[model samples]
Target: MGYLICILLYIAGIIIYGIVMGKKKVKTSDDFVVAGRQLPFMILIGTLLASWCGGGGITGSASVVYLYGPVVGTLHFAGAPIGMLLLYFISSKVRSSTKITVPEVFAARYGDGASIIAVICIMLAYVGLCATQIKAAGNIISLITGMDANLATVLSAVGILLLTVSGGMISVAYTDAVSALLMVGGFLLAIPLLIGRAGGWSEAMAAIPAERLTGTGGLGVIAILGYMIPTISLLLGDQNMMQRFASAKSAEEAKKSNLGLFAAEITVCVLIILMCTIGIALFPSLDVPSNIIFSLAVNYLPFVLGAIVLVACVAFIVTTADSYLLSAATNVTYDVWGKYLNKNADDKQKIHFMRITILVLTVLAVVLTLFFPTILSLQMTAYTMYGAAITPALLFALFSKKVTKAGGIAGILTGGVVTVVWTMVLNSPYGIASAIVAVPAAVVVILLVSALTGFKGEETYRRLYENSKS
Candidate 1:
């Protein structure tokens, strides 16, 4: 009952926030979509962290920490930071570019055909990413409150939908920062209490599995790196991250936000690792791996603190759902509808189209929850497809002057097709990281194709590129 009350209050608070942000009278496509390109550093940093913190950052990381112990947890956390730093480099480029969205970068660099491919990859990939959070929320609510699984699932879905549709990105960014703060505070405050309850550090250490406790991820260094490569690659191309980059008030603001995000990632990941380590020592036999973090909070903390932490987790997931839905909506409206459906549509009509796309994407995300049985069972192909296909070309184009449109196109297609076939179709041979394999494969194709075709940059991009250098 306490958990349910906390969750309901949180939902009410979010809806009210939505109503407020929507009242601003969106005037331009930039106004409706990216808040007129005026997001400051603090909010950008917060929104970026909030989007990633989701069920996976708290619950999933905690769960993995508890089961695999500190070493593997540390490795995974360390691996994720690589993606953040990569984003730092990529954002420096992406933020300065004359592009509005990922596909715009594609079209600006390659052509219309490339833009279409970019849109397809982002839409397909983002839903799977969003669904993972939905599944996590369903599992979290079901475990903590002892509600009927089906009822919990539907209720959680509605919560995500309401929050997502509320004010779109504007709502998502501000609310996410608030949620991230709460989640950090909740975890930090609860840790000592949890540790005291578990007896002491030595006792907690005694409780964990030996293999899970130490060395190159117990799953081997190669295997762990395999899982991380794609995420690392994603720093360059992930729309969620890129949109935030574009949303920053300036290129320097974007770079600063990425730096701050790195700090938050380290701090929050450590907090979560501690909670998970402590939970491992405190609990009895654990059944669901994903439920470990929430289970620990419910089992140990006093009602007030537990409820605060519970809301934090819910906020994380809710903000993630909203962020993803907004990103997916942009791909359609900006990349597809605004460009093709009504190329000459005014800012007002484009804003209208974006709002409709947000609602449509949210509906689809809700419906998607019905199919996947487990949160982890929800396809990560969304991650792989976009990360593998679009990320490589974008990163290289930013760093290497030699990269041509032909190379960019070759890389996008090669990365996209090979990653899908390797991870999904051919089963990612030899257990290599799909990204390790995917990036090099795309790079090879890009190099080969560019060499064959003698591609060059267009005048619009050339002028922008020259201006930036000048």
Candidate 2:
């Protein structure tokens, strides 16, 4: 009864916080989509942190770190820091530009058609990753509390859908900031307590598979690079990062925030690493490492501390689910619907479209989780697809003014075809990470195709290619 009360109280608090915070954001679509383009530094950091360090990082990577050890965790969690570092390189330009989305930037550079196509590709790839976050929420509630995973998953989805409908990006960011505060507070308290529970730090280090620490799984250097390449590429072009940059008050703030985000990511990674390591050390016999963080909390910690951790876990998942749903909705509403279906749609219609789209997406994500396998596989598949298909083309387009329209098309088609064909149909088997080969394959195809067809969208093929060089 005590544990149930703690849980209920927390659920109530977070929900109320989201609603109260989101109450002011319904004035316009711009406010909902981009936070009125004036999010302060702290809020931007909170939202970005909350979005990136979701169930995927807390549970998914925690599980990887616990089982596979630091090597995999680096690829999974630390890879995010790498991503933010890459973002800082272009943070100013991206933020200052009037473009609304990553694909919008592509549209600005190349053409509307190119941007629209990029949106289609990226949105499809992000579905699985977003679905898995919802799945993790359900899995944890069921596994730790002995509830029903399906029911919990459904409830979690409904909550996110409602949160999104209430405020869209405004609601999403506010909740993300709140979640971030809760996450840092909960994890900071729980890590030390968890380590102490595990018979101290030394004992925690002594736990886990020996090979998990070494970061090698019989895969040679080629195989290691193969695995990492996808993460590296995706970080370069992810919509989540783009949206955050777009939300910052200024270009300078965006760049500075990312720099701070990089530092914070390093610190947070260490904390999560410690948490996972402690879990592995203490709970060696646990059936599933993913549930180890909160399960350990509720089992050993008092109901009070346990509830904090539970709230933190829930916050982590909610923050991410809302952000992803928001981003995907943005892509569909602004990129697809606004651009193609209803070029003349007003601001009110746009907001309504986004609200309805998020509802549909939340439902779709819930259904996917019900039918899908583990969250880890779903996340990996989604990341791999986006990393290979969209990351490079977008990055090249960012600095390459001379990239011909024909070349852009070639790049997109080649990337999409190779990524889906190899990963989904053929299954990338070689030692090289699919991105390593796939990105280059895309570049070469785009270049050659543009040379032959002179298919530059707006700029001539030769001029675009030359501009890339200059």
Candidate 3:
């Protein structure tokens, strides 16, 4: 009953906040989509941290750390911070652009054809990513409330849709900021308590399999790299990340936010690994590894602390779902419907269309959750699909003057196609991750094709370079 009250109160506060912000701030499409490009440094950093560390980081990473050990799990989770560190160098460039969606950025460089492919690839990946959050949310709720899993999933999807539709980026970003604080504080407080509960750090270490303490955790090097690449690739070109950068008050603020995110992300990553390691010690016989953190919250911690951490986890999942859902909806509203269908959509029309897209996509995500067996599996597949398909081409277009239109199109098509075929058609042949094959394949196609096509002088690259200089 205490857990239920905390969770419900948290949800209600978020919803009410969304409603209040939507009415006051979301007056125009810009306000709805990017918070009118006025996000301060702290909020931007918080949203970036919260959004990225969602179900994938919480439930998914917890599962991995429980199965493997701290060493292997830490390496597996290193991709995001590494990617954020790299992104810091280019975040200024990303923020300087006026585009709202990644597809818009692509369309500027490679034309409408490339944008269309980007839309397809982004939608595929983001919807799957959104589904993972919904699935995680359901799992958390079911574990806490003893509700039916499927019904909980449907309720989770509805809550995310409501929050997203309420104020778009305004509500999402602000809620993300709040969520970030709660998440960090809750986890930080729980760590020492959890460590003490597990009979201190050394005793906890003695409780687990010795092999789990090894560097590889008995998993192959290839598999570890496979797990790492999708996250790095996704972070490098994730539309959600780009949108947060775009939302910053200035290019400098965007760059600074990355630095903050890196620090926070590293802190959270270490905490997750430690907490899950403690979980392994306490619950070695548990059937489902994904439940490690939640189980710890319920069984290990004191009631109030457990409720707080659980609420924080819920906030993470909800914010991530809405952020991705809103980003995917942006692709449809700006790239597809506004660009091709209406071409002259007013602010009201665009916002309306985006809200509708949110509803439609939420339903799609709920259906997608049925296909994947676990949050980690779904998370990797979505990450690989988007990372392989869009990251190489987008990065090349942004950083290289040699990239050609034909090359960009070919790269997007090849990367996306290879990821789909490798994962779905071939069952990830030999259990190798699609990213290992697909990312390199995309990069090669972009270089080889661009070389053949010859430099055509990318106007977008030239423009962005001039902007950076000025």
Candidate 4:
């Protein structure tokens, strides 16, 4: 009952914070979408950290550590921080761009056709990503309160929707900042307690599977690369990351925020690895690996410590869900409705449309959660879908002058189609991830098509790629 009370308090606090911030900070569509372009360095870092380190980082990575051990798990998860480091190089350019959505970025460089394709891919990918968070939240709540999982899922989705619909980016970013702190603090407190309860570091090490202790965790290079590439690609082109960059006060703040984000990301990755490793040592055989972290918190730690960790985990999942939910809705508002359906939409109409889209997308995400069997599978699929479909074209637009509009459209279409075929139709043939095949295919197509078509958007390319240098 105490645990339930704590979780409820945390939820109530976040909802209240989101509502209050929404009323105070969110007035125009610009404010709702990008926080009036005034986010400071620390808040930028916090939002980035909390948004990226969602269900995938907490539950999905925990499952990997439980199965593969710490070494391989850490390597598998390293793609995110590595991607953040790579994004750091281009943070200034990303921030300098006036575009809000990834689709808008495509439209600026590749034309409207590419923008339409991008909206399709983003909606497909982000809905799934949002669903993963909902699924994780449901699992956490169910475990904490002994509630029915489906009912818990509905409640979790409601919480995300309420928070997201309240203030858009303003609510999402500020709540994300708070969640990031709680997430790190909880993990910091839980790690030592978990390891100590498992009979200390040495004894815990003794109990882990020998294969898990090895560098590869017996998964080998090909499999590890499969896991790593999609995350890297996703981060490189994630709409949530791009939106946060757009929210920063200036390019310099955006660049500096990347450094803070990298530090926070690495900290979370290491802490999760240690906690999951301890979980493996204590519970050598569990029916569900994803539940390892929650299991440790509920069954092993003391009441206070367990409640803190649980609240932190909930914060991670809830913040991520709302971030993606809001981001996907932004893609619709800016790229689809505002761009095509209602070119003359006022600030009031745009905000209303965005809020309505959020509610619709929330329903879509809840439906999607029923399709995937596990958080990891859904996570990889969503990551690969967005990464392959958008990242190749996006990175080319950002860095290359030779890319043609024809090439960009072809790349986005090919990447999205191939991912669907590979994962949904062929069932990820031979146990390989779609990213292993789809990303390279998209890149190759982009290069070949651009070479054939000749450059057409040189001026736009200069604006996006060269002018930002000034």
Candidate 5:
């Protein structure tokens, strides 16, 4: 009952924060979608850190490390920080393009067909990511109250939807800032308590299997690549990160935030790895190893400290779910609806459409969560699909001037189609990640098609690209 109260208080607090943030002056679609493009470096860093250190980080990575051992699993969490560091080079470029979403970038560089395809890929990837967060929320709720998992899922979804529907990115950014502080503090305080309760690091290490302690964790090189590459790929072109970059107040702040984000992400990765490693050691025989981190926070720590960590976990899940939902819905509103359905729609109309889209998306995410077998599998599938399908075209379009429209469109189609077929139709082809095949395939098609076309639009695109950089 005490645990339930703590969770309720946290939910109530987010509700209040959402309502307050939503009241901020919002008169334009730009404001709703990108926080009026006025977010400073600090807020940008918070939201970026909060959004990425989410379901995939907490439950999904924890589950992988717990089951397969930390060596291979750490790579899953490590890729994001590495990606952040790499992003430092491009963050200013992304912001300088003055695009609200990756699709906007696509449409600007590649054309409407490419933009539409990018939207499809974003929807496929982000909705699954939103669903993963919902799954983590449900798992957290069920672990604490022993509630029916379905009921918990519905309740968690409603809470997330409520907060998200209120104020798009404006609310998301502010609340995510608060969530970042809570999450970092909660984890910092909880890990030591957990370590102490688990009978110290030495005992915990003894409880873990000898083989699990090795760097390879008994997994093959190919298997580790499967984990590492997709995460790196997703980070390179993640729409949520791109959207946050677009929201920055200036190009310098946009680039600078990556440095802070990299630092925060490194801190989060180490903490999660430690907590999860300790969790697996303490609860080796639990039925659901994925929930080990949450379980340790709830069942092993002191009640007040446990409650803080639980709320922190909730913040992680909710912030991520809402961020992805907003990103995907933004694509639908601007890239699809604003582009095709209502090209002349005003700010008010677009905002209304975005809210309705959020509701619709929440429902879709709920369904996906109910069907997916595990959060880790779903998370990886979503990451690989986006990374393979979209990142190749995105990176090529952003960095290279020689890419032709024909080549760009073909690359988007091939990458997205191949990832879906590889995962859904062919069962991932010898257990390798779809990106291994899809990204290279997309890149090859892009190069071959562009070369055949003699870089048809190179001079024109180069001018536009140079202007964005300036």
Candidate 6:
């Protein structure tokens, strides 16, 4: 009950902070969406770390490690570090280009058709991304408090919606910095306590299966690749990450922030894997492995420490949910409605639309929880959808000067269609991830179509690349 109360208070406090920010700092859509493109490097680092390593790392990655083993967990997460490194290069180009959303980047290069397709794909991907965070939050709250999962989902959604709609990026980014500190502190504190309770390293190592200790956990090569590709693709094209770059004060700040984010992500990934395996050692007969972290906090640790860790984990869930919700709403407002539906809409009008869109998207995210059994299950699908559909075109157009507009359109269409059909219709034939098929398909289409159609123009590419220089 103390854990529950502490977490509830934290949630209430952040929501109130968000409301205050909305009234004071978010008068214009620019302030609301990107904080007027002036976020400092330290705040960017915190927001990037906080948003990236949330429920996805804590709940989704932990569940994979518990069920599969360290090998799969390592493979699943290896792409994130690689993706962040790649983003280090990609961020400068994005910041220099001054594109607010990924679709805006697409529109600048590939024209309106590319932008429209990107809007559809972004909405599809982000709604699922947001849904996974919402589900993870509900799972943690339910496990700790013994509340009904459905009620927990509703409550979690409401808090996330409030935080996201309250002040857009301004609220989300500042709160995320605090959440990141709490997350790292919570895990650091729990490590010693958990090890003491588990009877030390050697006993803990012997408690789980020997196969789980191996490099592959007895799994095949294709299975590992399936886990890796989606993660890389998701990081490569994540609009939430892209928007953070756009929010940076300068291109150099955006580039430097990735270094900080890379360090934070690696630390969080290693700690989460350690905690999950330890969870298996402590509770070998646990019926549900996905609840490993929360179960340990409630049942294994002392009261004060457990409450702190619990609140931190809940903060992780809340921060991530709100980030994606705000990103997706930004897509509808700036990319979709602002361009096509309301070309002359003022800042206040766009901000109102963004709030309405956020409310609807939150409802959809909650509804999606009923379909997936776990956060990890939906995470892969959502990640693949964005990585496969959007990343190829977005990256190629941003960096490749000779790339034709036709090629961008072809890549988007092929990648999006292939991922949906393979996952939903074919049900992942041969146990290969949709990313294994979709990413290569998108790349192939981009290359072939561009070669056939020839270059569209070099001046736009030249302008973007020239400004991108540090």
Clashing residue pairs in all predictions, respectively, total: 0, 9, 0, 0, 0, 0
Worst 10 residues of 3 by lDDT: 461-470
User: What are the RMSDs of all candidates, in order?
Assistant: 2.4, 3.8, 1.4, 1.5, 1.7, 1.6
Taken over the whole model, the C-alpha lDDT of each candidate is 0.75, 0.74, 0.91, 0.89, 0.85, 0.87
Write model 4 residue lDDT over 355-378, tens digit each, in one string. 999999999999998899999999
User: Candidate 6 on 1-470: residue-level lDDT in tens?
Assistant: 77778998999999999999889999899899888888988899999988788777888778878877777787778889999998889888788875778888788788888988998998888889888888888887788778999898898999899999999999999999999988888888898889878899788888888888888877778878887888899888888888888889988999999999999999888888888888878988677677788899898998888888888888988999898888888888998899888999999999999999999999998998898887887888898999999999888988888888899999999999999999999999988889999999999999999999987658756645454433
Once fitted onto the true fold, the runs of candidate 6 whose alpha carbons sit more than 4 angstroms away are 462-470
Looking at candidate 2, what is the lDDT of residue 387? 75
Mind giving the per-residue lDDT tens digits that candidate 5 earns over 1-470? 68878887887888777777777646688888889889978889999988888888888888878887777777778788888888898888888875678887778778888889889888989999999999899988888889999889889999999989887888888889888888889889888887787788888889898878888888777778888888988999888888898888878888899999999999888888888888878887778777888888877888888888888888888999999999999999998998899989999999899989999999999999877889988998899888887888888877888888888888888888888899899988777878788878988998898899876565635543455532
Off by over 4 Å in 2: 1-14, 20-22, 217-223, 430-433, 447-470
Candidate number of the best lDDT: 3
Candidate 3: tens digits of C-alpha lDDT, residues 1-470: 68878987898899889999999999999999989889988999899998899999988878889998999999998998999988987788888776768888788788899999999999999999999999999998899889999999999898888999999999999999999999989999999998899889999999999889999999999999998999999999999998998899888889999999999999999989989999889998777788889999999899999999999999999999999999999999999999889998999999999999999999999999999999999999999999999999988877887788889999999999999999999998887999999999999999999899897655667654444321
- Clashing pairs for model 2 are 226-433, 402-464, 402-465, 403-464, 404-456, 405-456, 405-457, 406-455, 406-456
The regions of model 4 sitting more than 4 angstroms off are 463-470
Model 2 agreement with the true structure over 302-387: per-residue lDDT tens digits? 77787887777877787788888888899999888998899999988998898888888888787777655667656766777777
- Pairs of colliding residues, candidate 6: none
Q: Of 2 and 6, which scores higher on TM-score?
A: 6
